[model samples]
Target: MKNARYLPLLLCLCWGGQAFADTPLDLSHPAAPTVHVEINNVKGKVTIIAWDRNEVHVGGLLGDGAAPLSIEGSENNLSIKVQAQGHNGWFNWSGDKAMSDTELNINVPRAASLKVNVVSAPLSVDGIDGGDIAVNSVSGRVRIDARTPMLEAVTVSGNVAFSGHAKQAKLQTVSGDILAPSLGQNADLQTVSGHIQASGGPWAQLNLSTVSGDVQLTGELAPSGTMSIDSMSGDVQLQFPASLSSSVHASTFSGDLRSDFGTPKQPEHGPGSTLDTVAGNGNGKISVETFSGDLRIRKQD
Candidate 1:
């Protein structure tokens, strides 16, 4: 799910100095409570996940202002909005630029949804352990750590990394590295110009594709259907399980096939044996495709 909000995010820069609140807000409003917060910092990160308890926990810095950061709770949803006291731009033409706001962090229930869009800051989502997450960042690094059924993440100028088991996932970036802990036999991943890596644990769905990056799969995954991965300007290396079978088809317009496994039965199909021949015939699956990159399948220990 993609959210397109054309709103200008909070900008913290030097303008008019506002009074400072000696203390930050520390309160426990658990269970479907929506709390909003504002973080002022030149560099910071956000970590959110699902928990067994029913409460909302938040703690972060305030961009120099006597006015207390506003946190409004409406039912199960919490919104944390920061109001930078000064109207000055994030930085002046001085020696070095500095952020005029404080860093913001919050801990909420995993089942709750989050809407976080930042300007010139790094954003991270961990232990998603709950429902779907909708996030976007302009120049900050974006990351999601959870085992949800579905996940969608996008970043314009930062690296994207995911380390966990997932049922289904979709991630992309203009120029960043993409990594996913392989799924049971049926998982998929795609990217534009970064390296793609996935580890398979069971028999599920697997697909990896990239335009100008390398694709790698390292882990034990079930074999019934085909696992597909492709790269435009890089090599594709896949390390399969000991007992699984895979049908891989790879070809590069200019690069030669550098396969370490059995050669494909046909020449038209570069090299690489089917699931049935490697360790044993696959459970009887479908297809896997990798292009513009070298394809290598190794067994995991």
Candidate 2:
């Protein structure tokens, strides 16, 4: 009879261990129309999708040794975080290794402002509109497809791809390529040793720079927009609309300059080259400079 009494307790203990080893998560919270959402994770994949409902839903499996998911705040703002034992945030994620990876799939309001930070994990966000968005990761690819007033994504040694529109956007990486097929109006992209490719913008203001990576830009410019591109030792290819209107200025230290708008002028006594000309009404400005990178500028057919 005494053994029977302990049987339920033993079963409960075993079930508890099982639950901790493989935690199934399904949580929901009421949110405002344009609620703010913040989430942090380490070494796991996070996927965030925008939904019409005025609620936030978090689902997926929590890896072992991770602290119970921490969710705080109210309908106006929300914060979600998953940490391993002794993990004090992004700076102190080296304490525990038991939590190999935690898969997180979160759903937020369509217009919710979002900020996500992760280390060694991939992040994906899509379908958000009219709210601010920011993502930071280390050694993991970050992809975003959203339309917002402000957007920023940064990573190290991982590719960053953005396919959406924003009033203002910034994407940066080190040793990783950047691809923006549908870039926004006012944007800046930078890289240390990674290539940059951008298109689909009649951008009002655009800036692109790289240390040792090639740059390719194909798109139109706004009526009075401005663009600046700089590179060191990497080639540059720029394609503009057939009805382009800009004051083009280009210079190279020891590289070549090729353009359809005008001929490159070589100094009579130096090894450098320069191109300065105007296209259309010259309402906009375009500048390209490189230390040792060749520049090619052409008008779309």
Q: Write the per-residue lDDT of candidate 2 for residues 203-278, one digit (tens) a residue.
A: 8999999989999899999989999999999999999987899999999999888999889999989777899999
Instruction: Find the number of clashing residue pairs for candidate 1.
Output: 44
User: Number of backbone collisions per candidate, in order?
Assistant: 44, 0
Estimate TM-scores for all models: 0.70, 0.91
lDDT tens per residue, model 1, 166-233: 56666666677776664544555666777766665664656666787777777654646555555666
The TM-score of candidate 1 is 0.70
In model 1, the Cα lDDT at residue 212 comes to 75
RMSD of each: 10.8, 4.3
Q: What is the model-wide C-alpha lDDT for candidate 1?
A: 0.56
lDDT of 1 at 187: 58
Report model 2's TM-score to 2 decimal places.
0.91
| Model 1 worst lDDT window (10 residues) | 8-17
**Alpha-carbon shift of residue 174 in model 2 (angstroms):** 0.5
